[model samples]
Target chain A: MSQRHAVITGAASGIGAATAKALRRKGYWITALDLNDPGPLADLWHPIDLDARPYRLPEFDLPVDVLVNAAGLPPRPTTEAKVLRVNFLALRRVTEHLLPHMKKGGAIVNVASKAGAKWRENIAQVKRLIGQANDACLDDFVSAEKIDTVRSYDLSKEAVVVWTKKMTAGLVERGLRMNSVSPAAVETPILGDFTRALGERSTRGIELTKRSGTPDEIAGVIAFLASPSSEWVRGCNIEADGGLTAILDTENTIRPD
Target chain B: MSQRHAVITGAASGIGAATAKALRRKGYWITALDLNDPGPLADLWHPIDLDARPYRLPEFDLPVDVLVNAAGLPPRPTTEAKVLRVNFLALRRVTEHLLPHMKKGGAIVNVASKAGAKWRENIAQVKRLIGQANDACLDDFVSAEKIDTVRSYDLSKEAVVVWTKKMTAGLVERGLRMNSVSPAAVETPILGDFTRALGERSTRGIELTKRSGTPDEIAGVIAFLASPSSEWVRGCNIEADGGLTAILDTENTIRPD
Candidate 1:
């Protein structure tokens, strides 16, 4: 019998690769998907260019038991369009295409970010403007507005969290589980890009938490969500940021003036 | 001297109506924007359908000192498209559109919901997929997929939180402020829709929290975000949620039955 199958996006490197390796250790037969031919894991890795491609299941077909949408673009102003296309739209395509193949009791783990936490304050408006725009309108809006940089990255992830929350009920009834993981300042190659996109001050603040996470540290959480152990955990966004999100008490103050 | 100009969306009834009243009482000029005309606020009410028409500034254009995005669709499945359009897209339009009209120290408060807190778990994936879809894609995807009502509501709110975070850097540098207010179960007609959408079990859970908030209660938080006292607070999703989010912990604890 085939070992339980797992599919990971952006599986060539970083957290995606780590998650694939972790799942392999957990006895899953893996199919790693990415733009590069992730050699050595050739039997598992399926090269994919998300921007130019639609996720056709035949491209990397397996009886997918667990899916980790780890494919994404990091923060960068120059790569804004690529970021939206790859990170947001492409992620949705992969999920929508693969969701049909999900086995009973299968799990889908999506990676978001702590940057998206504040969306609650403005979601009511998002809900109102859900589907009224065409591609032309979107393009027109973007061009008219001249929006560039990592804000798109932040916005795309905001939609991901929304989409995940939107899909949990169907997944539940189908015996499939869906959840998200938001990590802060993981020590990855993406660090350089993130620092460049958002200034040194902000990056330093994230790093000051004294807890730049390892790939495995994040993989562990993804693994937990992808595992049956977290079956009841639906529509949850687990903050693996080591308490960076907790509000500081300004009252117990020491001023550096 | 111009009375402080305020733009309130979703002013047809409920929280939007209540907020318009509250802001008017504070001696601010009000310009209510909604599809349905909420007759007789103090200054003016501009009724327009955001989804069906393009927004145009009024003839008596005063500088918008405070803009409150409160227009939204109630929590219902068929209404998901409408919800997302008004709640997310329109809010973005208003904020971006009015930025030019806003004074240096202006405030923008978008009314979000408590359901958005789950972003930490799936932060990576969420950051990937926002604002990249065209209308056709969104419609096709939303229709083909079965969404969880509660999760959908929460997800839309999560997008707002993310947007708020993205706006913070710009707002601070420009001497403006942007924040979100999330109420728990509010005593609005939407509560019935929310209860019906979430079904009986979760509705009971909300009631157990012991404080179904009033519109004025949430409006108070919005007013605070609009005021100078909240200057230091930018990109914060203030939870007027009556601690319902706290229950996320108790429910997560595994108990031996």
Candidate 2:
């Protein structure tokens, strides 16, 4: 049989890049999409921009067996609107556009953040925002709801978490599975954003893990979700947050930001 | 000082009523709101229609020391719209309206469900939805998102969990605290909802604690969050789900829907 194809976003850097290389070494053909070129780690490269939604994937003759959405913007000086546009709208647009090309037994794994853990508290709004197919309507809904841009980053990841579960029941019948990975404070360029917002105590003071995770650490879990090992897993998010969430649950400490 | 005021919602039955009784016994002057009369447990009772938003909570002479939002609908055959209106919108409307009556060192504990544990995944969307206040716009927002009514129950609770955390920072600036209690399968009138939707295996198969929790058990946690004991907790959610979530966390099982 021909090698399986895995389409990965954010393939240029961080978890996305790490996942692209890992999947490649694991014998899966990688169709990498990102704003940056991944050098030679990827077999087929799509230099795509995530800001533009309704993202149409290039034609693929081989069956796309896995989809790994890893592209995202961390909390920074950018507007929250842009954060939602890239992390959520773009991810959805690409997934829906690519779904028909995927076959039975295929899977989708979106990389979410621990920061968006409160998503359960906001499922109604999540369903509301995810219903919009493109940028204009989604932003319109966001504006009407009056969500400030400051929260766009965490909120976008939260949307992906809900979308992952919401799409599960329907996707399973079509012979597809979906899941998300909520990583806690991975050591990436984005770690600085968190440190600034949360102070040095953010990473140092609390946490049983005691250190941030590496990109490859996150990629390992991403690969597992995209594989058949997680067949019975169904619509669940793997909290590969280094037991920080578990510690929080045990300590009954701040229910996590 | 005058007996501190504690405002409790869903005081008609289940966790809400249990929390009211627990708070009252702990020396709080209970100002209870519910669709049904509290009979005699309440010092002052307000008959509330949760389906109605922007509810005019009756005037009170004393300051509110704690606000416990325990109102909700279980997963059943109901329009997702109605579920969102009641669980999320009404909860928000009442919480915001009553904020003025609460002083520094006050606390808000929203009774959420383990079913909404996926809330961590939907934080961004949750924030967006929570930013909105009324029914029509919220409905329009939900309709735009195209969420099915079938998952409304879990979604609403998820909203509550996120709202609890999201409001913490702002509320604390005004000298208030906010948190949520996510209970697991409880032996309430609605325990049947779990048995029906998830089968008997839902409760029996999983959990370190074999039996479902009681309303008073959840109320105990609610009272703690509302008290000075949880003063340093900050913006977070307290999971009182009898180790079910902890088990899921360890086993990496399907996230509770």
Candidate 3:
């Protein structure tokens, strides 16, 4: 059989690189997009900065079997505009741009974060961001909403989770699937930035899970969501956080009446 | 390497039987427990009814690598007490009994249902049921809560989802993992019963998803949760419902402030 094709953003490092490797093991041709080159890991490489305007995606000759949006930025040291623009805006742009090239049974997996678990609590803001036009300036929105760097990162992911759910019915009708995976305190280059930004909150979550998760562990979940094995799984934000979300969720559960 | 051992309840038919097959393909030695013989599908078959009192489970000589609690009953034609006993009480009983026999890296996947997605809204009652002693009378609790057959099934699965989260921290400490899968409108033997009981709710979910999911689709998710690939994934209740839960969640989302 011919090899299937997969398009993955942020394929230069961390979870995106790991997902590229995992899909390669499954006999997929990797089409990688990143600011840095993905080296030989990608069968095809596209170098593009997601923060750049005009949001152009390359055309693919082969029908895409899977699309993984793994590119993102952490809160600390980064501007609120950059965080929201890269994490949410660019991620959605890549997905919408590539949807027409995806196969009928194709799947899309967005790398959201456990920080977005409280999306319901901030639904109004999440929806407002999602409702924004593709061309709208994120800086103005961030200023108007008084979004700090940390809140920008959190709300960006929240938008990813909510937007993933909102797009499910339409995507399923087109014989396609879309889902998201939220990992908590992963041991990546950005881990330091997260710890610096959230301090004890980040450390406490890692403490609860015993340790931070490896990129490969999170990649495994992304691979599963991108595979035919998870055909019936759609628009779900899977928390691959080593029980961190569960611990917090259980602790906050309402008491019996 | 020798084949790993797996213990699956409700292995006679439906998702249970399909999970047995999926795990078998992954080279796990299947120990099936059910009211009927699993025939060639099981490496060892223990004929037992989940509704029977005393809740006995056979002792495993081999260390179990996986335990899948797939045993469940639908609402129609079944009493409220029977549904709760078979779905929640017996499931928890079997898990506790077999946890001692499981390997250090063992995993447990419980078959929950999408009907239980409203667990947060009914957290109080769900916790009340989960807090009951192992030998507590489910019939008395059902009567006190005024739970009908449908609510009984829903609440039972809700207990499974919530209990799965509640157990994560302790299980992770022991080098074990536990998770659940919620499938919407699966084409199992009990599908007719669900359609009859839920009426429009069941059919509407199927309609939104385009078609009812096959048992194999749900089993595929259970198998992934049981595998080592999902090592960092603990206590997550995966919605393998083809976006049914997403549709409902999106529809109920709060408007922008």
Predicted complex 1: DockQ: 0.02
Better of 1 and 2 by lDDT: 2
- Steric clash pairs (candidate 3): none
Question: For residues B1-257, could you state the per-residue lDDT of candidate 3 as single tens digits?
Answer: 77899999998899999999998988889999999998888999988988877656787899999999999999955498888878888889899999999899999999999988889999989988887775358778878899997899899899999999999999999999999999989888889999999999998898888899999999999989999899999999999999988888887783323
* Candidate 2 interface RMSD value: 13.3
Candidate No. with top lDDT: 3
What TM-score describes the B chain of model 2? 0.89
Lowest lDDT sum, 10 consecutive residues, model 2 chain B, at: B248-257
Residue A255 error, candidate 2, Å:
12
Ranking by DockQ: 3, 2, 1
How much is B96 displaced in model 1, in angstroms? 1.0
Tens-place lDDT per residue, model 3, A1-257, is: 66889999999999999999999999999999999999988999999899888657788888999999999999965489888888998899889999999999999999999989889899989988887775357778888999987899899999999989989989998999999999999988889999999889999999999999999999999999998899999999999999998888888883322
Better of 2 and 3 by lDDT: 3
Please tell me the interface RMSD, in Å, for model 3: 2.0
Interface RMSD of each: 15.5, 13.3, 2.0
Using TM-score, give the best candidate's number.
3
**Cα lDDT of all candidates, in order?**
0.66, 0.73, 0.90
Off by over 4 Å in 2: A53-56, A137-143, A198-201, A204-208, A253-257, B1-257
User: Which tens-of-lDDT digit does each residue in B72-95 have in candidate 2?
Assistant: 876565466777888888888888
Candidate 3 deviant stretches above 4 angstroms: A134-136, A254-257, B134-136, B254-257
